[model samples]
Target: MMDTMFLKAALAVYFVSVLGYVTSIYVRRVMVAKVSTWIFFLAFLCHTISFIFRYLETGHTPVISIYETLSFFAWAMAGVYLAFQPKTKTRVLGAFVSPVTFLLMIAASKGLEGYVSIPEVLKSNLVPLHVILSVTGEALFALASFAGAMYLIQEGLIKNKKVSGFSRMLPSLSDLDRINHFCLMWGFPLLTLGVLVGSLWARTAWGSHWQWDPKQVWTLVAWVFYALLLHQRLAIGWKGHKAAFLSLLAFAILLVSLVAINLFFVTAHSFI
Candidate 1:
């Protein structure tokens, strides 16, 4: 109950942050965006507190249900974006990030009354490690996609000779590409490790290293997709538009697969 209360509080604060970010973009005020970042941080702190309370109540990581998964994913998105702020010039990127986080929080709210019991197979400590690592990696990819989307918008404006005031408000194309590169470099390895850990857990729980379940198969597909993107990025010296486009493509496929797997197909991972 306390967790729920805190979650509601976080959601409210996140909404305000979203409004602040959008307002900053429209008004072209860096100061407002900076203030929004602080508000977003406050919301993240509340979200963190909510998770702690949920863990205390659940006696495990609170990622066992659709409600928890969406909440955790939203938290990861906000955390990853905030983490990047100090090292990068991405303050305006919150215009993209906040809305996505708010939507996730809203979706999470819809499932709040439908919390499912964790299956015995998911009780292993690996659940937290696998879920956290994988979800965080996915969050990074989400950031990459956002950056790529921004890059595309900025690129289009530049190419069309439509460099207006709004285009000027966006982060530099080079900076967006760098964020894309950084996220790809880091997200792939984290996701690989997460898959390996999940496989180990699967071996113990289901007596196999790999299951041909739709979820597993699709996850592998997504992994290989990113792996290829990373390989192209490093080996072939891909950057800028090409890299940004592929990152958006990969993330799009991954997002579609994730929803399809969880909603349309039955699998070991459907507990979420």
Candidate 2:
């Protein structure tokens, strides 16, 4: 009962945060931005508490269900945004990001009926660590993809003289491109560490470092896509739309691996 109430409250706050972000885009009032920022911060706090309570209620990490996994990603997304806030003027990007986070929260809200439990194999400590690091790392890369996609969209509009509405709300294309590259450069190492940790965990549990499981195969594919992007950007002087396109390509791979493949396919690594 308490869990239900807390979850409800958390979802409410997430919705409020979404509205706040939308309002920030239109109002142009400094006071409005301040209010919305506070609202989002408050929403994040409520979400943190809700996740904590859920954790206390269940001994397992909250990565067992697709809903919970999405919720965790939303949290990590907000965390990454908050971290980058002071360093860069990416607050406008939040107008795009907050809605995504809200949708994830709403998705999480959809399926909470049963007492969720971890599978027997997933109860291991390594599995939990692997999930946490890998998911969080992926979350950062997801944000980078969002930034990169917007960068390309905005870049096209500027190239074609169509800057208005949400396009105007975005930062300069240069800034977006720079941040996109920055995010990949920063996120890649974490992602590599996550893959490494997960590989070690897999070897321990399944007696093979590489299983070619659907999850493993797709994850490696995503990694290689980003790896190629990094190489193109650094070694071959790729920039602007090219890099942004690569980022979008990597994001597509991630979506297929994270969402589509996991949903439709059977695999030994399907913890969710």
Q: Can you write out model 1's per-residue Cα lDDT over 114-197, one digit (the tens) per residue? A: 246778778888978988888888889999999999999999999999897568988899999999999988888988898899
Identify the runs in model 1 with alpha carbons over 4 angstroms from their true place: 113-116
The runs of at least 3 residues in candidate 2 whose Cα sits more than 4 Å from the true structure, single-residue gaps closed, are 1-4, 164-166
- Candidate 2's clash total is 0
**For model 2, how does the per-residue alpha-carbon lDDT over 1-272 read when each residue is reduced to its tens digit?**
45556767767876786787778778755456556656767777777777777777886776677888888888888778777866777677777777888888888878754556666767777766766777787887888888888888898888888876557678887888887888888778777887887788878788888888887788889999999999999999898998988888898888888888767999886664
Scored against the true structure, residue 71 in model 1 reaches a CA lDDT of 89
lDDT of each: 0.88, 0.78
Error of 2 at 249 (Å): 1.1
* Candidate 1 clash pair list: none
Give me the overall lDDT of model 1: 0.88
> How accurate locally is residue 18 in candidate 1, as Cα lDDT from 0 to 100?
94
